[model samples]
Every structure is written in C-alpha cells, then in structure tokens.
Target chain A: MKNNIVEKIWQQHVVHRQAGFPDVLRIDFALLHEVTSAQAFAMIERKNLSVQNPEHFLATIDHSIPTRKNRHEIYDKTAKNQIELLRKNCQNHGIPLCDLDSSHQGIVHVVGPELGITQPGMTLVCGDSHTATHGAFGSLAFGIGTSTLAHVFAAGAILMKQPKVMRVHFNGQLPANTYAKDMIMYLIAQIGIGGATGHVIEYTGEAVTALSMEQRMTLCNMSIECGAIAGLVAPDETTFAYIKDRPYAPKGQQWETAKSYWQSLSSDAGCRYDQTIELDITDLQPQVSWGTNPEQSIAINQVIPFSNKTKESLDYVKLKSAQSIAGLTIDWAFVGSCTNGRIEDLRVVADILAGHKIAKQVTMYIVPGSEQVMHQAQKEGLDTIFTEAGAEFRMPGCSMCLGMNDDKVPPGSRCISSTNRNFIGRQGTGSITHLASPATVAFSALAGFITSSYAEQQPQKEAS
Target chain B: MNTAIKQIKGLCAPMMIDDIDTDIIIPAQYLTQTSKDGYGQYAFSRLKQADADFVLNQQKYQTAKILIAGDNFGCGSSREHAVWAIQELGFQAIIAPSFADIFSNNARKNGLVLIDQPLEICELLAAAAQQNDLIISIDLVNAVFKTDQQTFPFVINPFFQHCITEGQDELDYLCSHLSEIKAHHQNAKGQTIFLAGAGVAQ
Candidate 1:
C-alpha cells in the first residue's frame, strides 16, 4: 500500500498496535537537557530502572546553566542542583554527557544535527518542544514529558496516537531579507496558534526546498509555536549533503546505503494527506510579531490590527493598535535561541554590523545556539565585528530565551528578539517581546527601534 | 500515577481564558526544582496575579477537583509540570473546548483525565465559575459529563481511558508487552543494519 513518509515512518517504528489505542512506537534516540531531566532521572532511580539503551541516550546542560563568563559553578541554587543532578544521573547511568566544557555541548537540538546525531528515518524524543527541529531531516522527532522520559529510559519506546498529516506547500520565491523565520512567522499568522492542533505538518514546494538545512531547522523548530506535533521536510540531496562527514553520521559504504534509504523516505506520489495548504511566499515580506502570540504577526511595514485578542495583547505589550510596528523604540535586541542562533544567523547579523555600529541606546546580544556555532563564528571573526560594533557576544545556551538564568530582559522593557514564543512575560516578567528574523533584529539594533533591513535608507551615525 | 479516576464530582474552577499556556500555569522559574511536589502553590501563579479573583485563588474554589477551561487550554510548552501542577493543585480532571497536543499527551501519561467538549458547552460550563451549587460530575467510563441541566458526551483515546479506569500507568502497560517489544526491536535491527563498504567519499 502506498503511503506518505509520515505513515511509513510510523509503520517502521510500531512495536505494538491495537485498535482505538495509541501504537507503541520504538524510539531510536532520546535527548535530555538539564532543566527537564532531573525529575525523570530521579524517577528512574526510585523505580530501579537502568537506562535500557545507554548508548542511545545523550545528555546535555543548556537551559539552567548561566551563559556568563564563568568557567564553572552556577550561582542559583536551583539551577546548580539541576545541573549537578544531570551530571550525576548521566554518570550513574553510563549515558554520554555533553558537559559544560565539551566542544559538542550546546542546545540539544542545535548540537544534534551539527554532530550528525540526528538522522533521517529515526524516532527521537527530547524533553523540549523544539525537538521538532530534527524533523527537518525527515525524522519523526517531538518533545515528551518527564513521565514519558522516564518510560523511555526504562523501555526505549513510547505509546503515541498517530497524528493526522497536513502538507503545507510553500510556492514561489521568498523575497530578499525574508528568511525561513519570516516564512514560518508568516505561516503562523495565516493559521492561528491553534490552527495546526493534532497534526504533523510536512512543509513542501519550491520555497521550502530552497531553504538551507540550517534554515529548514529554523522552520521546523517553531512548529511547536503553531501547536503542531511536528514539522517535517522530506530529505533530499541538500539534506544528505548536510549529513555527510558529520561526527556521528554513518561513514563510507554505510553512508551510501543510508543515503539510498533516506532518498526513499519521501512521500510517494498520489499519496493522500488529511489536509493540504497552498502558501505563496513570492509576495511574502519580512514578518514581525506585534502582539503577545506568534499569530499576531504582520509584515514589517504593517500596523497592528484590531483582532479579537489585539486589545488584550496591546494592554499587555503596551503597544497601541493601528500603530505602525516600524520605528517602535526597543530597549534591547536579542539574536539567539533554538530558533535563530545558528552560525548562518550569526553570519547575517555580523555582515550587517561589520562596519556599522549599533544605536547607543539599544543593548544588543548575539548568542550562538551551540558551542560549535560559537567556535565557527569566532573562526570567521564574526565575534570581532559584533564586539567592535558594541554588541555583546555571549556564550552558547538558551540565554534570555526564557530568562531562566541571570540573563533577562528587564521589566517594563521592550526587546526585539529572534527567539520563538513571544507570549506575555515570556522573556521576563513585564517584559514585552517583538519576534523577528535575524536580519530584522540586526537592523533594529542598528536603528535602536523595530525596523526592517529592506526599509528605505536613512543617514546613519556611528555609536558615540 | 496509578490512581484511578473513573469519576470526579466537584465544583468546577473555571479558567475562562483561551490558550492558557503552560507558562502561565507555572512560570519557567519554578520549573528548575527537581521535585514535582510543592507545585500546587505555583499553579496559575501568573494568571492569579493578573486577576486576583481567579477561581483557583478564591477560597470557594480551593478544593475543586474539576477544571473548566476555554479553547486551546494547556497550550504551549511540552512540560509535564503544567499537568503536575494541576494535579498537585487538586484537579483530577480538566474539561476544555480543546487542548494542545503535547499537553494533552502529558495529562494522559500522568493519569490526569482531560475531556474535550464542544466550545459552546465549555463556555457554558466556564460561565458557572465561582458559583456555589454548580457541582459537575464526570463519568470517565461513559465519556460523559453531567450537570443539573444536561449531560454532554466527549471523546477520550481508548488507551488513556483504560489506563485511567484501571488505575494503571502507561509504562506499566508497556512493560507488560516487554517481550513483544524486544522481539520487534530485534527484527528492526536485523533489517536496517548495513555494513561499511569500500573506500567511499570521505
């Protein structure tokens, strides 16, 4: 029987299935991070269950660790304990640890693909919503709760209801300065935050295919923002090229076999999907969020519309409706997260700020997603240009993304961020967040306000 | 995790807001604690602050075991903390117009019953917030909720329904099928393993 790639993957991983019940699906890999794993590890100990597949388990410290200039030691007791718990748990269970100083350490999602640990046709679960980033490789990856994490630790599988498949075809060319971030931000606006509920989206068409692997990751990483279980792009030559010669990827002749299998992992022609959406990105402009939720976004030059939630969102964000989002003053500009902290995102910002200095009033931060990305940016001297332009080049972690650590957007401040999720008080209590692409964030930092890279040029002055 | 929830009859603590994300249920700051206990105090902390008269904070709704929420309840974040918080705060079940995918899954794993009803019904139930003598009864076995006026039918994934009624954890059920799972794993391994070939692109 012919089926789409999602159905084929489901069939490959089903260990047990009964009518009206979720299929017991086998997991190929389990990724763990600091904040969400401690309780799961403790549960495992209480139940006396060893990690069944130690080799398949990978642990890292990201969420709780301070991204400041410290060699070691977390000041916050809660964060310190969580990190310590993760290290202890990984050591006790013989699981591989991507410790703080490990070159491979970074956000779990970022490090996974860069190290070739994330591959096509595999089922991966992390205790994070952004785990959908792995779906960019044509794999079935999504976040699981701590209870499911403990279950996976004990049995290497999870029971899941098969999600209905939705295919979103992004037709036509994406205009300049509009990136994967814009494409997805625009998509979420088209469909409200709950539009894709109970479905897995397979992004297709010319615009999707044109995005680089890193860009594709950015696209899929925000699938959770739209309430989708996962977002996937079928593996192609570009996917294979990105996987080649990575640290954990199969090597030599095994590579050929693997590539052949990956090539076969696309949707068969004439296969049916539960829903199909046609989106034209040719006329798409750079998107920017005006309100609290991601769906409240509009094109950069547009004004905030009075939607059902607009009044409440405006009261929370302290922005007036019908006012142009452009030229709205911002206190800070952040360029990082599992969303847009890749090396490519850094390079774009660096290229923009190479000669121009940031506005004196705006405090800008360029946080790389992973240690490898940080190192790569430094090797390319992108760090020098950023620092010379007066932007802070911080270490890798989920800093300021949720402000779990010391890095936080001050209360009553407005920040233009490249991170996903602009929910009310997401960055900090009483902090308003405006979500945008890296290009827009960089330009906003340069202008000290919410502006676009494609806006008309004005006389610029160097920072005092 | 094994507590059976075949039925829950109590006053409904109505959170009428739509898209009550996990972040609002329990903020990120409180998630750092390794222990799942003590989360009840933080349940809906932000929302409670926003609206001081939030039903969860009202003394009248303190012991409520059922929650009536608006559309897309438990939206945002894959954290089980939201479910843990709700469970700790004394909610045995949540009735909503809809729920986010991950949050709904987390609720099932934790054996917290989540019933999805039509939006109109949810709104009707939510309208009875903080009012005395508005007891609601949920019958998990029949997948129906009963009020003084009417009974509304809802849907639950049969597997979760079985677990809830049997007082069984999902892991326990999965463990019962261990041998079958192991055999399937062996078969999958045998089929997918490929030998490293001669010198290929390095």
Candidate 2:
C-alpha cells in the first residue's frame, strides 16, 4: 500500500484490531502535564495498575506552574496540590519527570523537543492538545483526554480509529516579515476554525519544508486551533539534525539505525489524501487576530472584516467594522507559549527592542519556552535587552498563555499576545487579546498599539 | 446491530454555536480542581453570565439531557473537564454537525455520546427545542435519532457505539489485557519508540 506518514505509523503501531472496533494502537510515548493528569493518575490507582512501561512516559508540570522565578512558592493551594500530586505520582510509577527544579523542566511540548524525546515515526500522545507540536519530527502525535491517558498508563495503548488525511500545501516563498506563525494564522483565518475537523492535517510543500524545526513546531503547535487534534510534517534532514546528540537521543550505532528507519517514514509518491488545501503565502503579510477565535483574524495591513458571523466577536473585542486595528493602544504584550517561545522568537523581540524603549504605558512580558531556552536567551543577552526596554523577562513556563497562573491580563485591558487562542476571557476575565507574531507583539508593545514591524517609519536598529 | 445499546431517550437543549471550546465549556480557572467533580456547576459560566437566558440556563432545559450545537463543538484544548461538565449537567449525548477529535474522544471515553448530524438536521432539532419537553431518543444499535416529527439517521464509530451501549469504563478493557501488551513490547525491535536520544534497545 502506498501509505502516507500517518497510515504507515498507524499500521505499524496496531497492537490489535477487530472487525468493528477501533484499532488498539500502541503509544510509543506519553507526555503528561499537571492540569489534565491528576484525575488520570487517580483512575490508574483505582484500577490497581502501575505504569506498564515506565520508560515510555514523561511527566512535567507546565499548565499549572506559575512562570515566576520563585515558582516553588506556588500561591494557589489547588495548583500547589496538583503540582505536588504529579511529583508524587511520578515517584510512584518510576516514570521520569522533569520537576520544576530540573533544568529540563519547561512546557511539555518544548521540553519534549529540546531533550530529544520527540522523534520521527512514533505514535506519541499527550494529555495536552498542542502535543501536535511533536509531529514536526514525522511522528504520529496527538492530544489525549484524561481517560485515554489512564488507558496509556495501564496498557501503553488505546483504541484509536484512523483519521482521514488532509494535505495542506503551502506553496510559495514566504515574504519578508512573515513567519511560520503568520502562515498558520493565515490558513486558520482562511479556513474557518473548524475547517479540518476530524482529519489529521499533513502540512507539505516548499514553504513548509523550508521552515526550521523550531518554526515547524510553531506551525504545527496550533493544529488544534483549527479543530485538528494532530498535524504531521514528513521528516527531512532538518528534523534529523535537530534530534541528533540531544540528551535522550539514541547513541552511536543506535543513532545510525534510527536515522535510516526515519528516512523511510515519509509519504509515498502519489499517496492519497481525503481532502487537500492550498495556500500561496508569497503575498501574505504579518497577520493578527482581532477577535475571539483564531478564525477571526486578518492581515496586519487590513482592517477588521465585520459580518454577521463576526458581530459577536466584534462586540467582545470592542472592535468595529472597517476600522484600522493599528495604533489602537494595547496595555500589555506577551511573547511566549509552545507556539513561539523559542530562542529565535526572543531574538526577534530583542532585535527590535535593542535601542528602543517600550511605550511608557505598555507592559510587555517575555517568557522562554524552557529552561534551556531561558539559558540560551541569557547567553545571547536577550534578557538584558528585554528588561532594559521595560519588558519583564520571567522564568520558563506557560505564563499568561491561558491565565491559569498569577500572570493575568487585568480585566477589561487590551493586550497583544504571541500565544495561541484569543478565546474570550482567555487572558483574564474581560481581558481582550490581539493574537500576533512575536515580532508584531514586540513592535506593538513599543508603540502601545496594534502595529507591525513591517510598517515603514518604525524604529529600526541598524545591523552591527 | 441490536446489541447492548437499545435506545437513549432524553430532553434536548440547543447550543447552536461553532467552536464551543473547552475554555468556554469550563474556564481555565476551574481547571485547578484536581478531581473531576464540581465542574458541572461552572459549565458555560461565561456565556451564562453574558445573558441571563442562555439556552442551558433556560427553565425548559433545566432537565435537558441532550445538547444540539453547531459545527466544531468542543474545538480547543484537550481538557476532559468539558466533557465531565456536560455529563454532570445531565447530558447523555451532544448532536452536532461535527466535533473536534480530542473532545469527541474524551466524551466517548466518559460515556457521553456525540452524534454527528448535518446542519439542517441540527437546526430542525434546535428549533423544535423552543417548545417545552422536546424529548429525543437515539437508537445507537440502528444509528438513528427519533424526535416528535422526524427520524434522522446518524453515523457513529463502532468503538464509541460500544462504549455508550455497554456503559462500562474503558479502563477495564485496557487493564484486563495488560499482560499481552507488555509481552509484545519486549520484542518490539527496529522501532525507535524510546524518546530523547534515550535507549533504542541497541
């Protein structure tokens, strides 16, 4: 059979199959976080089953962990208990956990890639939907619910029916100032948020292949935003180079055998897909979401496109039809999350903030995705540039992305964020979030408005 | 097809909006609850606050056991709290044109049915929900939904069908056969299942 990457991995991992039942698929690895895993652990305990394969499970505290330097002093009693519960559960099962004190501790998706846990040709599952981030390495990865998590803990497999394949081909040389973030935002805005419902999106084409591993991770991270639980990118040399020599990567001879196996995991020529989508982003510019859902977004240069469908979003975002979104005064800017919190995203922000000061009224928060990213940013002096420009460079975690922690956009404030999802009250109750790229959020923080660096007359630091 | 699932009869409510995300279903603040129980009280908190007469809050659906929504129901975040909330709120199944995969899986695992019907069918079921006591019965064995006036056919994955009909936790299904899965893993050669440059069983 000329199978695509998803089919190949699905077939290889089928532990058992029946005539009418879903395939009992083997999960090669599972990632867990604090929020969704507590109940899952309780389920396993009720069933009297320890983790069947301890080596295959990795746990980390991200969603509920406060992104402050003194993260150990968690203030929320419930959040504190959940964090402690994860620590206790990991110890009980002997599963490896990247505790808050560990350098490897960070966002599960970010740490999974950084420590080389995510690899090609495996079926990886996490309790968090952004688990799609690992699919950038050619793995068949998706988010699971707490019940599914318990299933994995007990048997290392779960019943999974195959998802129909949707090939999203991004054909074009991406224009300057546009990024993988913009590419994905454009696709979501073009196709409504539910466009890819029930299908695994396979992002392919020249533009997609050209993205760095980090960038591909960023693009794939938002697959869930458009209702796809998983997304995949066929592995290439870029993927192998990124995975090589990392802490948990295979050693010496095992590396050679692993690479060869990965090489054969790509989609076959003329492989069939249930649906196909094409986007030419050559003319695409930096994009921004002015409304609640990711679909309520448009090019930075364009005004909010108001309509019957958008009336609800417009009322919530306090935006009007045909009004320019630029220079609309933002109270805060956040540049973090599994989506765009890598070293490269920080460098973009630092470059723009080198000699400029953030607007006196604007509050900018910069968070690294992981401790490794935190160290790398400090090594590059990006931390200095950020604080010097009046931005808060906090410790690594999913800080203001979902407002689970203490870092929240005050009620009724407007902020431009680099994180995914602008759901109503996501940042904080009554807080309005304008979703944009890190560069756009950084530049907007400097101007205290919804502006982009691509706009002329913006302050620019000359190349050294 | 007449198996464990005979028929599911319940009063239905209409929540006809797209992208009813987990965040909206149960906000992130409620996520801190380590256990899965109390989220029922806080389901759709934001929308209920926005308007006093949100559909779920209306007196007619006070005992509603079904939800009919637009496309992409439960679209964002993988928090099972959303499913737990709906289940706790006395919903047996949600009828929508489509559903996000994670939410669908979570619902099925928790024994909450998600019936995929086209928009016109959902709209008909929704409009019919205005009058009091709009009871609908789902025949999972035959894969069809029957209402006061219309009988509409639906499609369901056989796995989800079995979960609802059998009404048993999937944990039993997974744990009973654990020995076999572990035995199979030992000889799982040539596959790079070990993560992070970790042991590749070389």
Candidate 3:
C-alpha cells in the first residue's frame, strides 16, 4: 500500500520493528514542562537512568509562573518549587530550558511554533493535551503520560498505535464574524465529541487555507476536544512563511532544504480517509457551547437544544432543552487560553468592547496566552479597554481557564469563556461554562447574557 | 537503551477526586507547543489557592506513583497531556473507581496503567497514600495491583496488557507485520501487473 503521511513519518523515525497490535514507536522530540516534569525527573533520579536523548528533549516553565510580573520571586512558593525542579532537572540532564524570563518562554504550544521548534513532518510529544496544537504545522504531535515521559527520557521513544484518519473539508468562505474557533466548534457540535475517536483528522478546504497561521493553530488546538488524536493542515507557503524566521527554524541553505521537505508533507491527492466530514463555512456563524461538551454548541442567535430532541450522547451536558440562550445570564466572561488567547483574539475583543462597559453582574477577565501577547495587547491599549469596560486584565497564566492559578469562577456561577471545553467544573467546582469566541464573549460580557456582537453592532450600523 | 524490563515500585496515592477532566488535570491554558520542557512543574499547579496546598505540592507525596482517584477520572477533552503530566509527575498507575472512557483507553495505549478498583478500595488506597508509605505493587505480568492492606485485580484490555508486559509499543507491534503487510501489497501489485498484461494480449 502507498504510505500515507503518517506511515511515511513513522517509517522515517522507526528505531525498532516488532510484530504486534500495539507498537512502541521511538519519539523524535520529547517536550517537558514544570508541572509534570518535576516528578518524572525525580523518577529518573530514583531509577538512576540518564535521559537518553537530551538534544531531542526540550523544557519550558509556563503553567505556574504568573504572567502578571516577570519578577522571579513573585510566584507562590510551590509554584517556585515546581519551576526550580524543572530548572534543576533540565540543568542536570543538559537539556535546554526556556525559563520564564526568556523571550521564548510562553505557553508551550505557542512557544514551539514561535521558535520554529515545531516543524512540519515531525513527531512531537509533550505532557500538555494542546500538544495537538503543533499539528497545525502538519506534525504528528500528541500528549503522553508521565510514565511515558520517563520512558521517552530513558529511551527517546514511545509506543503508539496508528490511528485511522478523518478528513474534515471546509468548502466555503467563513463569514466575517466567524473565526476558526467558531468553525471548529460548529464541526464538533455536528459530529459530537466522540465522533473523531481513534482518528487523526486532516483539515482541508478553502476556508482552512485562508486562515492565518495563528488561526490555523487555533483550529488544530481544539481537535482534542472532539476526541481526535490530532488535527493537521497540509503544509503550504503559509506554513513555510510562518516558520521561516523562527529561532529554531533552519537558516540559510538548510532553510531551502526544510521548505522543500515541508512542501511534500501533504497527503497524496487520492489518498483515502477512513471517514470524511465536509462543512460549509459560509453558513457558519459565531458558535458557543451551551452545555458541558464542545459538541453541545449552537449559533449565538439560537436557543439551547431541547433535551428531548438531543441525542442520548448529549445528556451529560445537563442543559435544558429548548431554552433560548440569547438572553441567558452569565456571571463571568473569560477571553484567553492557548486556543483563543492570541493577540488577534484580543484585538477582536477590544474592538467589540471599545466604548462599552461590562454589565455590573458580569466579571470579565482577559488572559493572554503568553507574555509576548500580553505585552502586544498592552502596547495597543487593549488592556485599558478591558479594564475600563469592567474587565480585569490579569497576569498571564492558565488562570480561570482551568481552576488553576489564582483565577477561578466560584462554584454555581455561569461563565461565558473563550477557552475550549465547557466540561463540568471546567472553570471551577460546580461552575457552569459556555464556550464562545472572544468577540462573542466580549459582547456577552457587555449584555450580561449570551448574545452576539453582530447583533449589538447592528444598531451601530443602523445609526450610521 | 536497555531492553531489560525494569520493575517500578512505590507508594500510590490515588486521588479521591472524581471526573478529573483534562483541564483540571492539566488546565488548557498550559497547553502551549513549547518544548515539553518543564511541564511537570505545572501539573495541578492551579488547584492550590496557595501553591503549597495543592495535592501534589506536599513533599511527602511528591514521589508517589500510584494515584487513586474517583470515578471518571481523566474525563473531558482527550489531550494526551493529561497522561503526560500525570506520568511526568511520576505516576505509573492511576487507581480509580472508573476513568473517563477515552482517557483510560489512551492511558493504556501510551503505557500508563489505569487501575479501576472498587470505590471503597480506591478510597482506602488513597487514604493510605496520604498517611503512610502506601506501597502498591504492580505486576504487569499478572496484571494485578497489591497493597499491604488489600489485593485488587484490574483488567487491561488484552492487547495493551501484552504490549506493556513485553515492553513493546503499538508502532513496534505494527512494524513486526511489515513483511506480511508488504507481501499483501506485493500480491496486489502482481495481480495488477498480470491483469494489465492480459488486457494487452486480448
């Protein structure tokens, strides 16, 4: 059989061949972070085994380090210890680390592409689920467990089964108010969370091609939400241009060599997929998750699906059937995360909230994915708009996206979040979350309900 | 790399928390594509109001390998990072009443054992892990977990269990059949060639 992209990559990196249903593939890159690496490094010490491939391994500290200040001692002691442990582990093993103060230091997913460390046609492994984010560059990246982390440390390889491939083709132009975040959410809602189970989806179609590199990353970033192992876009000029000047990207003559190789990473024209899902971007609108799962979503102007009409698969979301979501009250509004916390997303939110103030009942928070993004937003005075609009501009970190760090919605509160996943207590214990794009989140914050910026902006258009 | 199988042993603290989604397990904000470096540092870093109060923050539990969690542990989005973070944080097996269906499957696929035990047993194991040296023995060959206080039998879908016991991976398993896979292709190629020749003759 002609090798697919996945098979070709697998063959290139094969260190050992064995017969069986479950195959252990050696890994090429092993990414680490402070939160999960501390224990793995300690385990290595306990085992007295040195990392087998320090060159292929990389580390960065992002999770616990407060994005608010770059000061070294500002983080809580435990956060400090975690960072310290990662530093010690990387130093001892001779593995390079991007400490918080480094320009390269940021959200692991964002830093990888920004530095050009996440290249196309490579297999990448990290302890973060958003590792799928790298698939935007056509790399086969996924997350692994700490034990697997140790195994990779000791052996520079992991055992993985080849998953079936699913092709999601986006055929038309996305509307103005629609973004990649909305596009993916619409697909998830249609296919259900487990629709892509055991499959790696390859996104195609004109709309996907038209997306900016950052937007493409956002599309791939949430593939995990729909139970996909990874999501990838075929490499093109857009991909090459984005990586051309990245710090770790090949330079000079090697740049040409790398570009040529990336160009060839696309699937053969007739390559067959196990499943195919086609979507029309023109028909899609800004989407938001009204229930717990990413799949339980609808357009902003729509009502919550009535439970009686929902498939059995959607019962877990606990959403009331037939409830109009347009005016649903909210307690919090969050705009950040690796998924939608980039500068572009912030720009969109700022545009929507420019002269408006957040409703009194709504407590809005904006977290940039990286310090770089934070600084860029501040430079553009977006931070002022957020604060003046009654939104708190907090330091960079995962924050309320997860109940981690200092930001969390109190239990029983309803929040409209720009982050992916509205799973039960995703924001906090007993907190209800609705996932929306940054623009929709901003609009909702101002209205104190789940509404659309398009509708709010309608009045301005009429006035003009 | 050593091919010899190494035995892993130590106290197991199964988290009592149930349905520990990926976000909570390793929040979404931390899911950046930076080198997988330093991720262990932020594992569960957000759970603590004061970082010191986090469950994994205590020095005594730092090295614990056995995690006892509640039902549907590792539920929500399927980011392998939850497994990576858990594994990177030194956990070998997660003993729970149950697991998020997908996470349990992925954990096994990635070589992290998910031990599903009775709720009572899981709670007891978690308590022991919190208080004293709660050493839990994981016999991959037997596919069983034994603690001084109790013996629990867990199921590893046969295919995955075989991979762990033999220290093999899924890719290795698939590659072993490369010759057979290649032969199948060769036969198909031969048939195509023969058909082309026959058509020309006709």
Candidate 4:
C-alpha cells in the first residue's frame, strides 16, 4: 500500500478514511475539456456548491472548437453555446481556462504535458478517456464521468477502487517503420482487447525506456483501447528533460526536489504484478485493425484472416475468412484523432503522401489534433502535401473520429481511420471503421484499398 | 432505510453484438433532452432496423434485467448515455469479459453493477440465454449469481458494492453527516469571529 502513488496522494489529503474500501483518493489536478465540462459545470451551479480548490482545476475548449478560425460565432450554434458555457463556468469558479486563442490551448492531453501541468508522481483526472496520455510523465491519470466531474468541481476529490496491476515489458530494439502507434496496436492484438481488463498496466523494459516523451505519450494514450484503467511509464531523465523548460514546471530548487521524488516513484525490483506480458520490439511492424475492435489487428505485412479461420470474427465484421485485405477497396481514409493526430503523425503522413495522388474512388481527410499541431503542419507544408494527394485538409477538432462534429461518414461506408474506436456507428449510423496507424491510412488512401506501403514499394525497388 | 428487493432478474439475451459503442447504446442525437426519460425505447434502435430478429425486439428478452456480452463490451467514447440507456432499458447488471474503463465507472456510479468474468463464462451465459428461458438470481448481499447452468461468483468494487447494497447514492451518503459538518463549521466560524485561534479565515 505504501508503494502505491494513489495511496501516497490519498494520505496527503485524508480528511477521513473508512475501512473495507480503498481510501477516498483526493484529486490534485482536474483537467477538463469543453464537451463534458460544460454540462458538469451546469450541474454544479444547480447544486450551489463552490469549487473547493480552484487552482487545481483547469479547462480547455477542444472537441467542438474549430481549428480554422478564432471567431466564436463562426461555429455551429451548439458548439458556440458549449464554448460559452466553459468560458462562463471558468470565470465563475475562479479556475484557469485555456481558451482557443491562448498559446497553451490544444488537445487537453497534449496541452497538459506541453505546459508541464502534467507532472511526475501526481494523480490527475480528466473528463476524457485519453487522460491516460498524461501517464507518460509517470502520473496516475484516468477518465471520469460528468457526475464525477461535478464531484471534482465541488470537492476536488474522488473515491476509487484499486485496480490490479499488469506490467507490460517490451525488450530489444524496434524495427524501422515501427512507431509508438504500431507498438500499442501490437500489444492489443497480442493480449486481446480485454487482456488487461480491471488492471492498471505499467509499460516498462528497454523499449519503453528508449522512447522519447512524445512517443511514450502515444503509447499511454491508447491504454483505454485495451480496457486498462490507465497505462504508465515510470519517469526518468527523458521525462525530466522534457519538463525542464515547460511553463508550469517547478523552478530551481523546487524542480530538483520534484526530480528526487520522481526518481523514487518507480516500482521496486522484484515487485510482483497480477499479470506480466513480454514482447520483442524488433518483431513489430505497423499494425492495422481489420475488424471492429482494436484487438482484431494484424501486422502491415500480414493478410486478413480467411473467413473459415476467423469464423467468429468474420461474422462480427461481415467479412469472408479468405478475403485478403490487400487491394480491398475503401470509401474513405481519415488521419487524425487523439490517438495518432500529433505533429509527428502529420509529418509521417506527409512523408508517405508527398508525391502521390489518392485513388479516385477514395476520399481522404486529414485533421490535425489541435490548433498548435495544425499550425505546425502548415509551417512544414504538410497540409499542402495532404491536399495535393486529393485529401481534404480539414480544420482541427475531433472531426470524423466520433462524429461529434459535422464531419461524418454516411451509412455502409467503409473507412480506414487513424482514430481509436471502430465500433459500429462510431463515425455515423452503420459506418464501418478500420483503425490503423497514419502511415497505413495514407498508403491505403493511395492504393484505394488496405495495402501496405512498405510491401508495395519494397518489391518495386528490389526489381529495379 | 429498508432493503429494496430487486424487482427484475433473469438471464439477459445479448442485445447487441461485440464492441457495442456508447453511440449505439444511446446516440448523441437524443442527448438534447434534459430528462433521462424515453431513452430506453431508442436504445439499440439503430441496430434493430425495424427487424424483429433483433434481440431487444423479442418479447421474452424485453423485460430481461441482465445483459451478457462478448469481449470489449463497451469500447468507445466516454458518453454516460451508454450507462443511462442500459439502466433505462431496465438492466441492473451487465456481465462481460471486459468493458470500456469510463463506461464501467459510469455504470457503477449510476447503480448499474458491471461484472467482469472470463470470456468462456460470458459465452456460456450467452449460450444459456439463447437455448431456453434462463433464470439468473443475483443476490446482492451474498455477491453470488445463480444461473441455470451454474452459480458463478462476481466481484464488485467494495466501495461501489457498499453503495449499491445500501441503496444510497453517493451524494446522499456524503450529505448524511450534515450535522457533524455543520457543527465543525460553526466552531470554526466562532473561532474566527472571536479571534481565538491563529488560523486564517476566508
């Protein structure tokens, strides 16, 4: 119990502790976005409860706010109302609000770390599932609902049940063309989507250590896909270096003290986990989810399972067992989401689609995860490359990913997307989604089908 | 307060297929309504497509209060509508190999018990529901479930288990000790007024 960060944090803020249940874990940081926080703040007003700790809570407008313009009235009326509510709530509650025009404004998960608000050895909660993305800094972060969001707004505390721990160890070196997105997809496919259910997964071993802070974030971002409460990578020099110059990071001696504490937060040697999964990073390739769930994935080089071989899975996806995904036509190709919509994702997609044109039948869309990322992509001319390839370069938002905005696929349309979930009607009513990494999505867009870029180009080079 | 007897019990037919997302559970289109009523009728309506073969359309499964689902039962957005729809559809419990983290938490907080069993066990329950009129008795006090095929043990988070067993909402539970809270506030207020303590008053 002493080894748990949740316990440590709980002890610091213990007004009272009851037996037979996990301690009422007091939250230190409550990160919120416009989509969920607007309703939660409304509930708080109705209850007449003031925020207990205003400084600890932060808000940003992300989901519905369009990336193109800063003009508030240009958006849909509902989106305009949501943003207004968030602004009004923050003003009333005395909490910090990172509005669209602010330099720190971005995706809630991205903005938190870049501003150094997401620090090591902290317990962070957000109203979005991708809050696990903050765990890259060695913090315990997970999503909470609007009701719980209201609770945090009022009291800055939450009651939590301790989750069983699972340590995912990835050793050896990663192969070329393999990225953090591929690494997570491989883990989900290997373990199955439910493999880490009811468990908090700790990503460790050499491969995790070798990753940069941004890469580590991408790994933790998709922990929800595997049914894990959250995923963490123990903080190290890389994490410290990333936060050293960030705006909110502690300064001077306080920073040193924070580092010393972070160093001691790692799991002790010989510490036992409820489950341990090992993977060789060298064997991984870019992975794609061929079926509805993230676990129904295969390596870029592999073929979709034959219907007889995947009778159960085929029934769910409505595909024949022998139908190879290679050359299978697609209607739409989308590249963006909290999952793989970062600056690096844009750079990679641009690199792949640089001189190529998208197939006539396939309609492609490239949405940046945030305004900052969109600006960065524009500075690098990635937007031009995407547009030249016959892909629509859309404004930043959670566009086409969850169909929360106007961007959505029509029913029965099959789309290769870089977003997280591929559940039925996730994009729109009856839209079929196949989740993939950015590179796979780009290549599939060019080929007008689910084909691998590496495989298609490899044979041509060898023959030449 | 007296213990309320659970009015509904049975083996629930699998309403939707695998990876049933929050949108399908309750679409965002219906989120405009302020009240949590009338959602049950629209729950899984998109998937039913006016077809009687849809499980929710069946007469026997209409009143079922439990749901048995495949692996990764609720994988998608963190919309609480999914939990609301399940509860509005009258399901008190959902048994699955796994659930989306946020969905499970929302389900528990809203008094819906989400049970995570192994895949094989879920498949067994799903089969039982399909084969015949399967009856499942969920004893909240004992934390045990008896199905036609077998009796299985399901574990709920102790804190949530307490809340559900006591039939107390979280807000009510926290507000129950208002007198003690009020007395403490009064004493602090008096100290501040009298300047009897060094602690600063807001």
RMSD of each: 3.2, 3.8, 10.9, 6.2
Model 2 spans > 4 angstroms off: A454-464, B1-5, B176-180, B194-202
Which residue pairs of candidate 4 clash?
A: A306-A321, A306-A322, A307-A321, A307-A322
Model 3: how far residue B41 lies from native, Å = 21
- Please state the Cα-based DockQ of model 1 relative to the true two-chain complex: 0.45
| Residue pairs clashing, model 1 | none
| TM-score ranking from best candidate downward | 1, 2, 4, 3
Q: How many residue pairs clash in each candidate?
A: 0, 8, 68, 4
Q: lDDT of candidate 1?
A: 0.85
TM-score evaluated only on chain B, model 2: 0.88
* lDDT string, candidate 2, A54-140, tens digits: 878888788877787788999999999988888898888887888877888889899888888888988899999899999899988
- Model 4: residue A217 alpha-carbon error in angstroms: 1.4
**Residue by residue across A245-348, what tens digits does model 1's lDDT show?**
87777877778878888888899999999999889998898899988888889998788887665677888888777777887888899999999999999999
The runs of at least 3 residues in candidate 3 whose Cα sits more than 4 Å from the true structure, single-residue gaps closed, are: A1-3, A70-77, A308-319, A454-464, B1-73, B77-102, B105-159, B163-202
Question: Which candidate, 1 or 3, has the higher TM-score?
Answer: 1
Chain B TM-scores of the candidates = 0.88, 0.88, 0.79, 0.79
Off by over 4 Å in 1: A454-464, B190-202
The count of backbone overlaps in candidate 2 is 8
Whichever of 2 and 4 has more lDDT, that candidate is 2
True contacts kept of each: 0.48, 0.67, 0.06, 0.19
Q: What TM-score does candidate 1 reach?
A: 0.96
Tell me the deviation in Å of residue A107 in model 1: 0.4
Q: Highest lDDT, which number?
A: 2
Query: What TM-score against the true fold does each predicted structure earn?
Result: 0.96, 0.96, 0.74, 0.85
